[model samples]
Target: MSHSHSPVSAPATNGHDLAARIAELLTQIDTVKAEYATLDKRANEVAGQLAQRFPVYDELYMSAATEYNRAQADLARTKQADTEPDIPLDDAEKASTPNQAVRSELSGSTHNAPISVNKLYRRIAQLAHPDKTDDSNKHTLFLEAKEAKKQGVLSELIRILALLTGDETRPEQLSQHQGQDALAEKLSRINVLRKELTLYRSQLMQLRNSPMARIVDLISTNTTLSITKAETLYKMTILQRVKELETNTSGIRQDIAFQSNMNKT
Candidate 1:
């Protein structure tokens, strides 16, 4: 009996080709990841410098914004409560207290669902599980995945999964055109990375155009203004801007209330 050897060799050849395609895609993904990390680090460093140079301005701005938001939320909640029917209270709580209304506002604001750290941990582990691979870096990948999950860094976990799995939408039954499909998926991912890179570049440009950043740039180029003087100027300018914003916010609030009263009437 003569047995054909072509059928046995074809599957092995296809497997090798598939592995090579996956490896190439992984390399490309790694390159994109490195570039993104660099951009993100630079953006953060620039932001940190701005914050450090003007700590008081940053703090005051944050506090004012927070207070404005909270006040607006409270006003809206009060208006909503006014439209609702009053419920009868128990004999012990016959008197309506200010604290009762405050508690209701707090309750409404505190209903967010809890994050499941364990679920994220499991997902990262499943993707980079060392038991599935004998590569030297498998152990390192597993450790990093575990730490990212522990710290609730979902983005890191997602990046790791993308590197390991090539494509999240990989079909269960890879057809004869598997290599073409893999290439297409990898190119799609690269497109996403390019878009993200553009966004980061735009953010960097915005930061560079900020008042504090412009002052820093001027000092760098002109060499006439000292760092201390430049920072002082930036602080003064930013404070004035903050005051203007606060005034505008207050005016808008008044206008909203007037319009609301008119609608009610």
Candidate 2:
């Protein structure tokens, strides 16, 4: 009796072919990077021409330059991934306190709030800073909130501070914290994207070493035909592993959303 083999199972049969496929993918990645770099260079040249033709087009030129740099960075990242397939992404660090977030806002302002860090610390402490809070729960929340702001949980930190300081009734007053919160959210999204990219790189490596290569080895070794069924089972195993990566990416996205919502508070 003869059994049919799946197309996906074919790749699981041999080492040489598996390695060749991986090498092909790496080549493709390199080709894409080269193409992107060429396009980016052309974009910058165009942007320069625009700037020369009309000084008022400075904003347009700047925007074009920004896009070109973004492309360049993306291509650089792809090249790095091809060179080092196993690089892992680091998680974003958590924020410190609402005061810290406000300080960041202050630093960005043309009119700096003369609120000295130490003075601000003392004044804020009088209201809701952990040292001033007598209730244990409020104190704990205050400390956590402060640390979150310091680490960069700007929105959550600010909201907590506002609630503790009797500013919860005035949501508009919390606008300063909004900018920081937005920045934190962006950083969190960046971290998730990096991790997703890393997972894809790892998946590429796994596909290169899949069970299809092992089945091929068995065939080359003149193994009995009965073991072909076993090879198909091995292909299922690799598919399951890839599924695990997909699940992980989903979880990371959920975490990013949760973090964003937490900041809005």
Candidate 3:
């Protein structure tokens, strides 16, 4: 069995301490998820308020935008279809294109994950013993465990072992093999959480930079600004965009109608 433990800084840190660290990390990740949700809700609320003030126009503007996008896509597709027959790929281009390139790659050797050893993997090996796989799923679980161990991913092994053995194994129960594998699993989870946090923050920043969010911030920034005044300010800003979309949508519909007539002729 491959040991798939991620390295926890102190190789000797007891399983109990590692579990505590894992708890702290999960709590922090959940907090970040909550923070992102709050800001997303705020941005949506601002949009809703604008829609409420301009109910009819709001619907028209959205409908028009969708129609405009669809027409533009259709136009592009039509142009491509009309011109594609005149241009044939050369020998080099044909070899590099999907039909040839993808087939060539598919005929090569399959890449495999690296393998290491761990106690949890040992436990998985025992539980998923080939001789005792009458449960049908046991063999599948064994393969998954083997793969996880090879990948040095103890967390996946832990999950599979729990399913095979029907035991709710906690982080502490996995303290075997000198706390190596479990510690690695904790670090893996932490690294994943850190990446998730970065992604969430980036999304939040994008929302903040959007026109609707900026308008909301601007109206709310003045502590003395009256509720009526703020409402008016939001409506005034969106009204211009709504008019622009209306014009664009009209133009797109006209173009689409002209194209349809030309196609028939």
Instruction: Give TM per candidate.
Output: 0.39, 0.23, 0.41
Residue lDDT tens for model 1, 165-206: 664432322333565555445544443444334434444444
Worst 10 residues of 2 by lDDT: 102-111
- Per-residue lDDT value at 30 in model 3: 69
Clashes of 3: 7
Collision count for each candidate, in order: 0, 22, 7
Error of 2 at 28 (Å): 0.7
> Model 1 misses residue 87 by how many Å?
28
lDDT of 2 by residue, 1-265 (tens): 9989888876342445544544555565455445434433333343234334444334332333333334434443544444423221211111122222211221121112211223323334456644455677566656665566456543344445455666442333333554444344443333333333343344334423434334334444655673564345434543453355356445545554555565566
Per-residue lDDT over 1-265 for candidate 3, one digit per residue giving the tens place of the 0 to 100 score: 8976677744565558767776776786567657655555555565566566667645554554455556555554554454322222222112122222111111110011111135556667666757544666787888887788778774476567666666433345444633657675665455444544554455556555555555557556766654456566555654665566567657766775676676678
RMSD of each: 15.7, 27.3, 18.3
Candidate 1 has which clashing residue pairs, if any? none
Better of 1 and 3 by lDDT: 3
For each candidate, the alpha-carbon lDDT, in order, equals 0.48, 0.40, 0.53
A best-first ranking of the candidates according to their TM-score comes to 3, 1, 2
